[model samples]
Target chain A: MASQEIETLAQALARLPGFGPRSARRAVLHLMKRREAAMLPLLRALEAVNERLSTCDMCGNVDTSNPCTVCADPRRDVRALCVVEEVSDLWALDRSRLFPGKFHVLGGRLSALEGVRPEDLSIDKLLRRVEAGGIDEVVLAMNATLEGQTTAHYIAERLERFPVRLTQLAHGLPVGGELDYLDEGTLAQALRARRPVS
Target chain B: MASQEIETLAQALARLPGFGPRSARRAVLHLMKRREAAMLPLLRALEAVNERLSTCDMCGNVDTSNPCTVCADPRRDVRALCVVEEVSDLWALDRSRLFPGKFHVLGGRLSALEGVRPEDLSIDKLLRRVEAGGIDEVVLAMNATLEGQTTAHYIAERLERFPVRLTQLAHGLPVGGELDYLDEGTLAQALRARRPVS
Candidate 1:
């Protein structure tokens, strides 16, 4: 009943994350139903983002502004830079509201099997930023994966010459986590990192 | 890390059917990544659809033209009218290529508990169309639900005076459907509608 143009649009929408063939067609129809209220606004927002968005040259954070809002803000502690593997992680951490510092996105962890090398990531850029003097600590807030650990170790070794403190997120039972469902590795790490009643 | 505007855009994108908060943010980033390849084309498609689309007065099919592509096509068999519950169903039936006829969308099935009245649907319009003559067959291609059957029966009673033959889709195990998992009702229907082992 719809036109070929609409069909083409549905096909494109299918390629987006979380959209399959059925859902893509449904989404296209939903968009058509909300033509004025939602469709045009989404289109306009996408256009605005496309026109102005880019990765931050300093920290690799994604935003419409060149340096990104975080890097541009003076209130953030320049002495403490939290390192993450991706912008999504950075956003997650931002939502956590635990960190009051800036960030450096490595883009991805070093994966030898996947051909992801240290040079493949923004590691050099991060090193340069840290080398410029001002940052006193680098927080390794990478994911709890082997590749993440490898990247963290590599970065720590590289930053050994610099006079900055190196730290990482503690390994423990996650907040609201169930001990019965936890793996042995996590349990052992939690036990090893446990402190007295204080 | 993104500006307030970009963040607002991501929030809006999150409201789409298949996209959650995280995937919506990812979708905005994806749109930015594929600005030329996907975003522009999708935007153009939405604009074109908005500019030209509306429901066909004849069949209730939503498309870029007033009469809709199906109703406007002279090649379609106007004599065999297929009735469906919604435009999405119409689209799905159209995709099947099994029926080469026009359509009538009822918008929704009768639901006593939900306070759905016959006057709330396009039943009057359908009756008027049928009364005008030239239609030889009317296929009640509604979903095989209690409400759908109720609607079909009501339509049949209303058009009792019409000379057109009334028909419906057959009930059976779906193509590639496993018999072991099928419901007793479906198995009984499949047995009743059995043909030569072809």
Candidate 2:
């Protein structure tokens, strides 16, 4: 008979994203198929992350170190900070090799419907970091979603009196995205911000 | 920014069934989001499984102990033995609770196409177990695939000298399967194996 431990492992796997009951079972079976090469490494990795993983106190990005690799790096521009809704967005931007500046993770967007308040986010720390005076620019790189825009507006208002100049990531049809699939709001905004041929 | 550790963790999750680059990244984010509740528990579970999970020496079923809980159980029918290609099949049969007998996991089916030989499977051990004899009946529970059938036929030939009554799992329209979607092979098998109404 299948042991209780296997069932419990499947239950835990089901809670992870991209896994349902069937997929969890499949994953467990696959793990059983290769206990040493795949499963053991995964177990060890999970244990390592569990022990060492923590969010940077300064930027709110999840990392192994407290200050995070990006925040701790001397090469990155501390004067220019990119503020995003989550750590994933920060990673995506960093992966592009376009942003050499440090980041501030907002934790999540302003979701009044979900009863999330400004206090729920790292906004206060962001404002304090900006007001503490070395930062010259604040890039509000929240998503284009309604809540994201709402959060950006709220942050912009909060930082109105600060010496730091505020900015936002551009919104338009995504690169390589089909024009036919582009929403009306994006199309309108793209047209309004249309650049002339250089 | 995402640290090297988080990236390593995501890479490990990607090796598991159903997770890819994007989904692995998402899983890592979700883990970071719920560190106290979900991630920690998963780590502990993985550690537990890693430390304890092993194959039973007698039955070849994966479990926490050497002989496994099922093989050690005295109440289960020792006379009837269900033979399957993998531990997963044993688990499936056990979950159904239709069989109260013990199991013998063959590890894998014969597949010349995939370079899997008779020597690759635990067929010798299975034969040894049967020859030791208290096993009155042996049920062949391999999958419906070509490899499973080939393996079953090979095993039947090997067990020809034994006094054990050999049988197989019944093939038919699945309990809830619709006729329209059923293949001709299944339909024919179902027709051939049709039973009288009680």
Q: Candidate 1 chain B: worst 10 consecutive residues by lDDT?
A: B26-35
lDDT of 1 by residue, A48-116 (tens): 776787878988877889888998998899999999998878888987778989999998999989999
- lDDT per residue, candidate 2, B1-198, as tens digits? 466667788898898878898899889888887998779877877777778888899999888778898899889999999999988788888888889899999988898888899999999999999999899999999999888999999999999999999999899999899999999999999999999998
Model 1 pairs in collision: none
**Tens-digit lDDT track of model 2 for A28-110:** 87886788877887887777777888878999888888888998999998889999998889888988879888899999999
Clashes of each: 0, 0
- Alpha-carbon RMSD to native, per candidate: 3.1, 2.8
Best candidate, lDDT: 2
Please identify model 2 stretches exceeding 4 Å from their true place: A179-198, B172-198
